[model samples]
Target: MPVDAPRPSAWRLLLIFSRIGLTSFGGGLSGWLLREFVQDRNWLSEEEFLNGLALSQALPGVNVKNMAIWIGFKLAGPAGAIAGFMGIIVPPAFIIVLMAVAFSKLTDYPLTSIALAGAAAAAIGLSASMAITAARRVPRRAFPLLCLAATFLAVGIFHWPLLWVVLGAGALSVAVEYRRLSSGEGI
Candidate 1:
């Protein structure tokens, strides 16, 4: 498929993306976000969703939020973007604020700390699940594997600065893409 722009209804987009934001627990919402909008719903093709993901990660407050905004803008222009952004943010923000207020009073109890510890563990599991999902999606190529290894070494082992790691990985990715393009291979 050519992967042209999508034209889903405004309300539908708002409702679907909003549901994603509300239901997504733990920290790996981005992968779920991708699956919902891209694979399950077919609102966006893989390439378009991947492009949006890249852009979202590149310039973002949050990856999922940025993705909603981008997809909203693409679908229905500025109004769609606003609807998507507000839909995703408002529900979560309201719930989080309420939880924070409740937790502030509850923090004195030992059970609250235990519950939080459980939540943290669940969050880690969710993050790992997301990583596995994303790894499955990554193209099986030497350069991408090399980049992944370097990233792991830089951030995981060396604990290098995040900016440097990102920059280095980005440069390597660009070089790999350029080489692939020159070789008449699919991107």
Candidate 2:
């Protein structure tokens, strides 16, 4: 979508975030956000959403909270950020507390572990979908492709610390891209 695409009202933003928060389980909330905002509503373009997702992941807090605030602010300004924060945090907080209480009692059952495993599988699928989408947007060039593969190998195969892999790969990618752009090669 364009920068001037219609924005949602704060209330609408709140409701959307709240629904995701309440229903979302396991991880991969980012994937769900990408689907809802980018695919379903066209409230944000894939690039815009991906940028925010990157920023959110790099930031110091919970990725979901950061994403909620980022999307909320993008769509509805400060009030939207507040609504997003509250909607994502509050309802889920209550549900988590309730689940915690219930799960404490149910932990003895094999079914509980099976149910958790199912949720984890679903989360992994969502995450993989988002990863494929992001990977598809990577420029089909050698440096970008190398960085992608190297990062995958370093983190996924070698079990390098994620922070170090990201910092190294991200810095190298930026430097190469900057040099290319400066030399008019990319242009």
Candidate 3:
């Protein structure tokens, strides 16, 4: 978006997101994105990248997909957004279908289950690591921390419906932040 910064072509954007999408196994895709779009390419700043990350997470769908859209839109508007969405989804979609078919055929084998379990554990680790990295950027204030914990407890422990929890918690959090801002408290 910068005048001086050379923008990547839409094709290039697709390729970049596609590569990240396909190769980012287990998890840590967001980390890969941050490194590629922010650190390596210098297309976006750290704050901008993190803000997109937060927005993507707060939204209901897959965080990585949301982030792909956000980054694409930021870089090249609507068409870029389409490219980003397709890049992240299309190639992997095919691969996943193929894998599912293959896995179904292999389901009866003990080694298949063991391999999948190991993969699942590694995926969890990657996700947890990403969460911790993202959490470090969250405000260290009591209110924010309480909100985080409440959301986690509701969704993770209580198994509350995510829609209601997100709406209620998001509204409350927004109201609280608004009040703080109105009171001249720095966010």
Predicted structure with the largest lDDT when compared to the true one: 2
Off by over 4 Å in 3: 1-5, 25-27, 152-161
TM-score of every model? 0.79, 0.86, 0.82
Worst 10 residues of 2 by lDDT: 1-10
Task: Give the whole-model CA lDDT for all candidates, comma-separated.
Answer: 0.79, 0.90, 0.86
Predicted candidate 3 versus true structure: per-residue lDDT over 1-187, tens digit per residue: 3568898877888999999888765567887788789879999987788889889988978989999999999998887898899999998888899989898888889999798788778767767866776777776899888988999999999999989998999999999999999999994
Superior candidate under lDDT, 1 versus 2: 2
Q: Rank the candidates by lDDT, best first.
A: 2, 3, 1
**Can you write out model 1's per-residue Cα lDDT over 1-187, one digit (the tens) per residue?**
2366457777877887778778766676766766777768677777777778779889848877898899888777887788789878888888889888998899789999898788778768777776776666777888788888989999999999989899889987988799889999983
Estimate candidate 3's RMSD in Å.
Answer: 2.7
Model 3: pairs clashing at backbone N, Cα or C within 3 Å: none
Clashes of each: 0, 0, 0
TM-score of 3: 0.82
Query: Distance from true position, residue 75, model 2, in Å?
Result: 0.6
Off by over 4 Å in 2: 2-5, 152-161, 182-187
The model with the greatest TM-score is 2
How much does candidate 1 score in TM-score? 0.79
